[model samples]
Target: MSTPVDTPAPATTGAAPAALDVLHRVFGYDAFRGQQAAIIDQVVQGGDALVLMPTGGGKSLCYQVPALVRSGIGVVVSPLIALMQDQVDALAANGVRAEFLNSTQGPDERRRVEQAVLAGQVDMLYLAPERLKLESTRALLDRATVSLFAIDEAHCVAQWGHDFRPDYLELSVLHERWPTIPRIALTATATPQTHREISARLGLDDAAHFVADFDRPNIQYRIEPKAAALQQLLKFIRTEHAGDAGIVYCLSRNSVERTAAALADQGIAALPYHAGLDAGIRARNQSRFLREDGIVMVATIAFGMGIDKPDVRFVAHLDLPKSVEGYYQETGRAGRDGLPSTAWLAYGLNDVVQQRRMIDQSDGDAAHRRQLSAHLDAMLALCETIECRRVRLLAYFGQEFAPGGRESTACGNCDTCIAPPEAWDGTVPAQKLLSTIVRLEREHRQRYGAGHLVDILVGKRSPRVAELGHDALSTFGIGADLGEQEWRAVVRQLLAQGFVAVAGDGYGTLVLSPTSADVLGGRTSVRMRREPIRASRPARATRRAAAQPDMPTEAVPLFEALRVWRSTQAKERSVPAYVVFSDATLRGIAATRPDSIEQLAEVSGVGAAKLETYGELVLEVVAAAA
Candidate 1:
């Protein structure tokens, strides 16, 4: 027997609301930020666009608003099934007729949504790319009139990207099939090369590219040397971000499990998420992290993409990421609501060796291997840079990082600017290393990795040195004054400065570059930042103060009451608490302490439907707290 699916009445049926009207009455915002209004206007006017907005920048509104304004259903192509469900659930909470089709749906449930879509009862239809790849699904889309096509996480179309999906390659058919419908592709992170690749692969070359400022000023970047990684991570969480929702990224499944268990043993609410976990456990853990306050999730990179939880207070990395793009996207998950957040990372020299080894050992042709190596080199340079981490990170994506002049203004948020590291003249050492590499290639006709070169420089008498007769080289004992660690730092700096290059194959051998001539001939002076000694005490995550909510002390009880009410509502509905009311909105309700529904309607996130649904209850909580 088939159960009848009740279709909720539309909020307003006759005329499409203006963009501002939709923003306020639907999504509960006073105005559009950044280029959101312009992007919405463009898409509503039936133009194609490629939107590169930072996470928590309201990328959803770009399509959601237009879907309400334009006739027919807006088709959003999402990649993950869980993400699709979450999105549709959130939309439904906001009184939007949103539905999703994915493998998680049984045949009857899927047919119900399909019937609704064809009947024009759904405003937005979310589908995984793999779903659209099915001929039956494509035929279904053809039968229904779609208002527009939105490709979220469009970077997945790039074959070289970290999160590539082969199904995304077939998305070009959207343009071919619905040639008249507007299309907008969006992603939180993309470098210049990736930007171009996404534009080309998605058949969005002709679309207007709206690249917002890649700078996430709310997130403070801090990187430290890995020493007692677990204890350091614990001290950081306990001291700085206690009782806040945060994520800890690990390099392996084992590390994730161990870290989670250790945090749990320490009385922290921690859970592990990795591909190795059973699907039910992974789903449950993810659900708890999204719904519960102050739960820490220890996970690999598989955990964060498309997660809509906006209150994540911090994202910490216990291991080095594969590339800058991966790091940027992962860290961007935090501070989505524009509150102060932390991006803390712990890395060591061994991370470099392991990352290089992985790249070299991977199955790929020379060109492919070279591409991967270039990506890693950029990331390594970021890790080792003494300049502002934000500046270097944004520069990787071709954005000039000049927030202010050095003498007058600057982004005082990053660790480097807050605690400046001293730079020392490395001209003499640079000359010696360059000379060593040249001699190794010219005299000995040999190229060696950093470890071998450092060994020879520091006068180590290894069997390989004796076999190669490398000790006979003049530059061998010249570098003996500097310890092996110091020499390693110098080589890494040289690689970063382009004075030296990593040779072919997995050995990571150093080779002289054309720029090395300038350093060797004393035509250019090299200045390298001295690596800070590993801290014996726990390092402070950031000098910045912890995030403080904007509310009066007297209203604190009211805020708690509202949270309790929201939790109850979310639990009753079997959805994440934020879907009932975000923390920011609850705070606003508390601070304002509205006495009536009309007054509560003025809150930033309170829309007509939400005001109608939860308005009276919110006021009741506020009044009761009195």
Candidate 2:
């Protein structure tokens, strides 16, 4: 489901001109953003395309325009019911004829939409990939004229993608059955390897592949040490993102409930969402998040795929995400309006230990285990790196991040660039940590996790240490120069650097890697990133400056008023406020304060349909504000 399903008007004879006309007539944008023009042209010309654009880089327009201008109705295969609902609603707001067939609808509603499909009354039709598995669905499509087939979130076809759906594997039948229908597959996040997998699985290897830059410069990335984590998260929301619509991601359902309750106790309008919750509760919470302002949803990874909320100001990670791809995909959900936003995470030594342990215990063959470990390793590299966060993030996706037209370098926006970390030599510290792990495995014939090892290194006479006879070890008290936290940092860095590994078939115990011998033999030195001494939260001015690319001070009143008015319209229409006009468009309206309908129509999001729908109302808001 998306914003631009067309009106099943007569097919235009020309591809480029028809697509360009649809862009201005249906959607509000004057011209295509990034590769939308080329992609749309390719699709309208009845050619297949594989588009890898960023989440908010006008990906919808590529298929939306062609689906409208082409000869017949477009069939879109989407994975999420909420996504389909939003897309159908947004397209309706744009005066486009879009209908979706999903389980969310009753039999009567489905019958009506199905009948419309048969009668050529629908412009674009949305369906879940699971729907295509039914012979009845295939027969319906066989009867209807399908101009194109757009596979949204096409990365799901990859067997190893973060969100893999078995039904996606069967999507290639779209080509097999309707061999001449132009197919377009779109995804927001995919590594080069995943991209290849998507192409091969979807049989789009022969299609035109469009890969836009994966960099999201508006998002400021920051990873903080997880200490007093609940308090830290509370302070972050209170100071950096107060009264903002954002998402908090936790790794477990229990964590989601606890975090959501904690935030609610603190008076934040936060709700919990996970598979364990009642289906109706989950749906209501998701709907509230989409429709209301400043509602924070604390959820597991299950909640976010294909969510189309545009004003999400921040996305916080209470625990380390499993991989770089997962991290990128989650963070991309924020700042979709091209406004400044934040991607914050609280990471610690236990994150590494827990992730490693999970990977070791995960059900898969050795190759799958290795694949999971590789993913965690990449995520750890991102969290532990002393270099610019954006550069490392982009490089992971096989792209070079060039901010402000500079070479691939520091973004001057992330936590690392804003307050660079010190890469101090820890060759001796590495030996001390590795020596402890070595002694535990060799001398005592036992292994332990970081807590026990750090206790030993810091010379703590804990009962476990005394019971295990670790106090008499030669390495005891030798590392007393550093505290327990410092020792844990050393262990974490070594683990991240691969000088040590977690023991196989053990309870998260530290074990030496093959490279540990190199460090112990004095052949390799270690460089550790010193966690900078910084304030737990940004200061008063930082809190005040939460809104990025701050608008003119004088326009504040008008903007807020317009927001209130937009909220009213959305509630009345029962659609997301963004489906009416994006924050960017509202900002444009506020800045221009256009009094006439013609002037208001010139704003970026005000297409011909919306111009006729809400132009007069917006003019009234502007006039009343004046």
Candidate 3:
């Protein structure tokens, strides 16, 4: 039986006219994105809200502007200390009275912040959920007047979310403690079910719910099946975006270190960032990535939540993310400045097995595991799909893309659009593979991994296949028409489409999913791509020419000068220059020839510290060049 869906109630009230004036005065913007104005208005009017906006969709302003305009302090509950510090730093740089209470602070410092809160001096106080459990913290919260309680990363409250925390489950007590205070729960990534879980867990029964579209129009999405993934990653980085600020995400800490080292060896300025690194080093590396340009931060998923860097040109995944929501959030870190960016991912059958094994090992409830598996299946389908990757991605998030419309462009700059491959009929091969699975009694027995199965079918008398006597089976040698690479591709596509599953044991054997019966029953047809031969390397001159931008001849020298200056500054500071000023920022400065510290400060990366440190030297260089 289908369960009835509950309808959302209308917002409790409207925002005050005074708040609108404050928003313009502080934020320097006239309006909000999507439902931001309405959400902010509701929050300002002392009504609870649950906001689910995509990354780079102005989730912060929904709470920030209201917190500034509202009467009392806005208490923001965040999960990560680094994220809280980043947000607080950015807000303080904008002249907002923001502070954070987390493990980083001493008791005396915490007491000072509490005193400031009690004195109504802080407009916003960011707290880690763990900090809320302290006796002193609860006592302060009991007495202090809070205009609104904001939960950032609200999806963490849901068990089905990729980054769930148990402390978030206790947040519902906020409503019981401070019944009159308005609560605003905000997250950049959450599915429809996750949204419901968050709303329920936060005790936001009468909250105004706002779900902005999850599609990131500026990001070009591409998925490549795993074969020489590292080489492909290097080619993409070197050929398309030689020196752009980007991130490379891995599924493991070891992979992060290895990939970072490999990129550095190839003359790329890369750094490893994971929980294993010391806190100081991680902070420095993160700051360098945020402040510098053209730095490739190879990190696990720990690196990019709440990162406000706007011009990250690319995001590459060395492994598949846990779910589509996680993938979207991680990829959304790029192209945030409304500029062109790329989201490239590489996956294989091994990734599927490992991910499935992870799900089986997790201690989540059955419903949560089922939901996660469904989400992962959707992600795998996206990876294997020959259709527009952006369309499938949006559909997973319950959003629709325009058919054959400009909105479907996906930047007109993805691998599939640029160089789509021809498809071949694979009905017979698929049937053989499915039949093999059943013939081996592999349905519940020891399922074979793709390599072993392909070896058996293609008549490669490997030691393992010989031992199993699978060469004597009727399905054996029937797939000889397909090469090893081609068979591997088919197996990957099948696994991705949920037509098969992988065993949770060490052997990582592949078993059939429920959908396999349809294929065996001749109810489905498969069309697969033939593996393309690797192309010769481009000529050196041609590669350099491709890397060069088509700037005006007069501007070229200035750009070079800026780059040289940036290189020197970066070397002296032991940081990447994009950390000093992005290429876009450099272009802006070179074009405008900002004459003073005040003018240079207006540049994106020329924050107060940078301006104070390098202002004079930059001005001298600019004046000399002019």
Candidate 4:
């Protein structure tokens, strides 16, 4: 027989079995979700891991449980101080020993926290990545027995990630200082490239990787053509999802402010949130949203990185995000509580042109630019697709979707299922449009936006047409059979189908792409939707009444009273009425007849502030009505 060597003992001496018992007793949950248990077990067994989970998928428990169940202290490197405080407060509520060190903490409090860590009084320590860059912090880590290093929102380590942070690049230094410590990196969103970059940059090449399904089946995804987006958004909020907690993401700070103001004017309880606002204001707004219920936050990309709110019922994108990854992460914030939710977006040709211009203007290499363009094109295709939005979304994450896969494979709750559009063949018109673009180049050495080009094609004799003398050209008057609107629709379809390209520098001048030749030469056919004439004011009024039937007859009077109450209360507090109660919530209160404080809490959009301030007034209105 071969000489038997001494086998290594099981690595259980440092494992905190008593802490695992505490996890079960305090949280009242028996087990973890999906790969959470495996990841936790591995970390407890002294192994590093990288986890990719979707929003509301319990990515927090992967590290949270390990932090509680491991020996020594668990150091979590996070980015936002507000998010840190939220996490710490939530943990403290559950009887977990968690504290954070950042600018938000006073010098004396920081010393106390540091002392707690040294004395083994704290189970988990949360630090901003900026803290890791400090020499003093590095020295502190050298002395403390860190059981694990958890990098939350770990995608920040990659330049290609949507929310890249330069400070995260220095996280590799952790391996040098704590070579024996196990580490785990977790993020709500990351692509394969981002995953590779995170593993490489953080020196977690040998770490176990666990990627959950990217699909959020509870979220109904829908994209509408950009036509009066604010009105469409308001209607959406007022109808199916009235009185629900939601987030409306805008592309700019001004859009955030204006949209929030418009919602307020309409009697919606909403708040504007962006980096431009002071930190205290943003924090207060965020806290009000979290501690209370049914408050809609109109924000930019600056909000909701590590937000832990569970009942976010919907997320609407008023503008296109820079990439599909960004779009997915932001939209994923909805329906986190496993309830039905909606992901609504309004996109137009202008969004595509603006995104292209930003990419071309960026100071990146040619390869990077090409990659960015390809990513944007993919996102555009997803937006215009008629199939299941969830299928297309998951495919972008490298997941193969089966055809007709409806068993949790596709969310049947989207707009396509609700109201499918009619499509028509426009191959002949598409060919004519391409031919017009070519003839225009031969006639005049100039590029034009879509409007002027459509004018020339449809033979509209405007001043610009007379000045250019384009009525004399053969292609100008020949295409008058199609209406101006019809020709414009053809152009839009051509752009979406990739038969034409828009110039990046000059507000998107029309340019023919290689695919144009295929359409012009009759090698490929094109089909498009007939451009629907916009409804007039009377038609809109008729449609709105027919579309939404839940608005009770009592709603109008209740709404008026709520508005008066809100105005008086807002004047007292010196804030907007929207800062008091939204129109939708007031409508619900009016319709539901909530007469008591508990009943008022059940009203949609009646949060803590409104309940504290106008609760009595609302009850009086209900009593008077009764």
Work out the TM-score per prediction: 0.86, 0.95, 0.83, 0.79
Candidate 1's residue-wise lDDT over 321-435, tens digit each?
A: 9889999999999988788889999876556666766776889798888888788888878877788888888888777666543332347777777776678999999988887
Off by more than 4 A, model 3:
1-25, 403-413, 421-424, 438-447, 466-469, 513-517, 527-626
Error in Å for residue 86 of model 2: 1.4
Highest lDDT model number: 2
Q: Provide the clash count, candidate 2.
A: 1
- By lDDT, the candidates rank as 2, 1, 3, 4
Model 4 agreement with the true structure over 1-626: per-residue lDDT tens digits = 01111111122222245444544554534445666666777788888888788998878777877777778888999997787866776565456688888988888998999988888888889999998899988888787878899999998888877899999998998788788889999988877778778878987777777777777866778887776899999988887567778999999999999999999899888999999999889988987776555789999999988877766878999998878899999988887756567798988767776676778787889998987887787788777666666777877886654535534444555665445546787888887777777877876877777778778778888899889887776777666888875676667667767888887655778888889899889898897765333322223235334533555665667766766776676556544344456455666777788868987877755544446656788798777767
TM-score of model 2 vs. true structure: 0.95
lDDT of each: 0.83, 0.87, 0.77, 0.76
Q: Cα miss at 243, model 3 (Å)?
A: 2.5
N/CA/C clash count, model 1:
2
Better of 2 and 4 by lDDT: 2
How far in Å is the alpha carbon of 82 misplaced in model 3?
1.8
Better of 1 and 2 by TM-score: 2
